[model samples]
Target: MDTITLWELVALAGAATLVGFSKTAVSGANTVSLAIFAAVLPARESTGILLPLLIVGDMFAVRAYRRHADWATLVRLFPAVAAGVVAGTVFMLWADDAAVRTSIGVILLVMASITVWRRRTAGQQAREQKGQGEEEGRGEPAGEGRQRARLKAGSYGVLGGFTTMVANAGGPVMSMYLLSAGFRKLGFLGTSAWFFLIVNVAKVPFSVGLGLIDRHSLLLDAGLALCVVPGAFLGRAVVDRINQRLFERLVIAATVVGGLQLLLR
Candidate 1:
C-alpha cells in the first residue's frame, strides 16, 4: 500500500498525542485517536496501528506514576479481564465491523451510565453517611467498600476486555472504575498504568493472531511512537491540575457521545 497522505500522517500524529494525553489526563478522549485510525486505515488494520501507540502511551503513563499502584486491585481484576478478552476475541472472529462497532458503542453507553449512576449514588451516600454521625471523613461502611470493589473489578474487567479487544477503548472503562474505587491522584495513575501495561502487552499475541499487527503496522507504529513523548510531557503537567471529579464526569459524557457517534455512523 502507498504511504499515508500528508494530511493523514498529520492526523495520525495528532491522534497519537491525544492517546498519550488520554492516558494521563482524560481517558475517554482516546476515542479521537480511534476515529482517526479508522478514518485512515481499514478497521481491522486500525487496531494494529493503534495497539503499539497505546503501548507507547502506557509506558509513559507507567513512568509518570510508577510508584503508586495497588497490587491487590490488579490481582483481583485480572482473571475476569482475561475471560472477557477471550470472549471479545471470539466475538471479533464472528462479528462484522458494523456489528463490532455497535456492540462496543452499546457497551460503552452502558458502562458510562453505570459509572454516572454509581457516582451519584456514592455522593449521596457519602453525604448521608457524613450527616448520620457515623463515619466523619470516611465515606462508606466496610461492607459497602467491599461491595464497591467487587462491582468495580467485575464490571470494569469485562468491559475493559471487550472494548480493548474490539477497538482499544478500554481506557475509559478502567478509568471510571478506578475513579469510583476512590484512589487518589497518584494511586489512580499508577494503578491504571500497571493495569493497562500488563493488559496491552498481553494483547500482542492475540492482536497478531487476528492479523491486527504485522510488519507494516510495526513500521507505522515506530513513526507514531515518537510523538507520544511530547504528549506525555504535556499530559504530566496537566494531570495534577485536573479536577478529578470534573474529569471523570467529562469522561463519562464524552464516552456516551462517542458511543452515539459509533452507533449512528
Candidate 2:
C-alpha cells in the first residue's frame, strides 16, 4: 500500500461522501469515487478497500428503506447473478488491473447502450401493440409485457454481475433495470438497497481469495466509512423527491461517461 498523503486523504473523503450519496440517492455518480480510489491506490487494492466503504453506505441505505423491497424479483435474479459472480471471479484471477478496469468500462458502456435501446424499443412496441389491440377490440396484451420482463431481467442480471465484480459498478446497471420495471420512489431505493447489500456481502469471499482485501485496505476502509454518514442522511431526505424517469436518464448518461473514461484512461 502506498503512503496516504494529506491531499489524497481529502480526496478520499470527498470521494467517499459522493459514493454514499450515489448509493442512496443518485447512483451513477459513484464513478467519481471509483476514479478517486483508483487514483489514490493501486487498482487491485482500490477495489478491496472500497468494498467495505460501500458496505457501510449500504448499511445506511438498508436502514432507510428496508420496508419496501421486492423479494420475488430478487429471488428470480439470484441464480443468474450467482453465475455472473463466479465468472467475474475467474476473470479477476487471470486479468491484470488495467485489463480489469478497461473491461469494466466497456461493460458499463455496453450496458448503458442496451438499457437506452431497450427503453426506446419497449416503448415503441408497447405503443404499436396498444394500437393493434384497439383494432382487435381487446385490452393491452399480457404476452408482450411478460416477454419484456424476461428480457430485461436476463440482460440486467448479467451486466450487473460483471460490472460489480470488476469495478463495484453495479449500481447504475441495476438502477436502470429497476427504473424500467416501473419501481417507484421508495420501492426503487429499498429494493436496490437490499439487492446490493446481499450481492456485495456475497462478494467478500471472492475478494478475499483474490487478495483484494488486506490489512492495509481494511484500515483505509474504516476512515472512508465515516464520510458515508452525512451523505447517507442527505440521500434519505432527498430520495422521495427524485423523479424516477429523470433520475434514471441522468444515471445512464453518467455511467456512459465514466465507462468511457475508464476505458480510454
Candidate 3:
C-alpha cells in the first residue's frame, strides 16, 4: 500500500466512492472506477482490490432495494453466467493484461451499441402501443416477447459473467440487460445489487486461488471502503431525482466512455 503515491490514493478513493454511487444509483458508472483502479494498480491486482469495495457498496444497495429484486430473472441468468465465468477463469490463466483490457473494451463497445439500438426499438414499441390505445401486446406477440426475453437473458448473462470475471466490468452489460427488460429504477437497482453480491462473493475463492486477492489487496480495500459510505448516501439521495430517460442516457454515456478509455489506454 505504501508503494502508491498520494495522488494515486486520492484517485482510488474517488473511484471507490463512485463504486458505491454506481451500485445504488448510476449502475454502470463504476466502469470509471475500474479504469481508475487499473490505472493506479497492476491491472490484475486492481480487480482484486476493487472486488471487496464493490461488495461493500452492493450491501448498501441490497439493503436499500432488496424487496424489488426479480428472482425469476436471476434464475434464468445464473446458468449462462456460470458458464461464462468458467470460460473467463480459463482465459485468465493464459491471457495478459493488454489482452483482457482490449477484449473487455470491445465487448463493452458492442454491448453499448446494442443497448442504444434496443432503446430505439423500445421507444418505437412504446409509440406503437400508444397509437393502439395502450392495448397490451397489440403490436407484438406474447410468445415473441418471451422468446426475445430468453435470448436477452442468455446472451447478456454470458457476457456479464465473462466481463465481470475478467475485469469487474460486468455492470455495464447488466445495466443494458435490465434496461432492455423494462425494469424501472428500483427493480434495476435491486436486481443488480443482489446479482453482483452473489456473483462477487462466488468469485472470492477463485480470486484467492489466482493470487489476485492477498493481504496487500485487503489492506488497500479497507482504506478505499471508507470512501464508499458517503458515495452510497449521495447515490440514494439522487437516484429518485433523476428521471428514467436521463438515467439510462447517463449510464450509456458513461459506459461508452469507459470502454473507449480501456481500449485506448
Best by TM-score: 3
Residues 116-170, candidate 2, lDDT per residue (tens digit)? 7756765655455543422211232345476676666877787688778888878
Q: Single out the weakest 10-residue window by summed lDDT for candidate 2.
A: 132-141
Q: Which model, 1 or 3, shows the larger lDDT?
A: 3
Tens digit of per-residue lDDT, candidate 1, span 142-166: 4556777687688779878878888
> lDDT per prediction?
0.76, 0.76, 0.80
What is the lDDT ranking, best to worst?
3, 1, 2
lDDT of the structure predicted as candidate 2: 0.76
* Local accuracy of candidate 3 as per-residue lDDT tens digits, 1-265: 7789999999999999999988888775687788778767767677788989999999999999898788888898998899878888888888787887777667667767866786687676555445443221112323457778788789999988988888888876887677656565566777888999999999888888888899989988888899999999999998868676776787678667877887899
**Can you give the lDDT of residue 210 in candidate 1?**
84
Q: Is candidate 1 or candidate 2 better by TM-score?
A: 1
Show where candidate 2 strays beyond 4 Å. 111-151, 241-261
Question: Residue 167 error for model 2, in Å?
Answer: 0.9
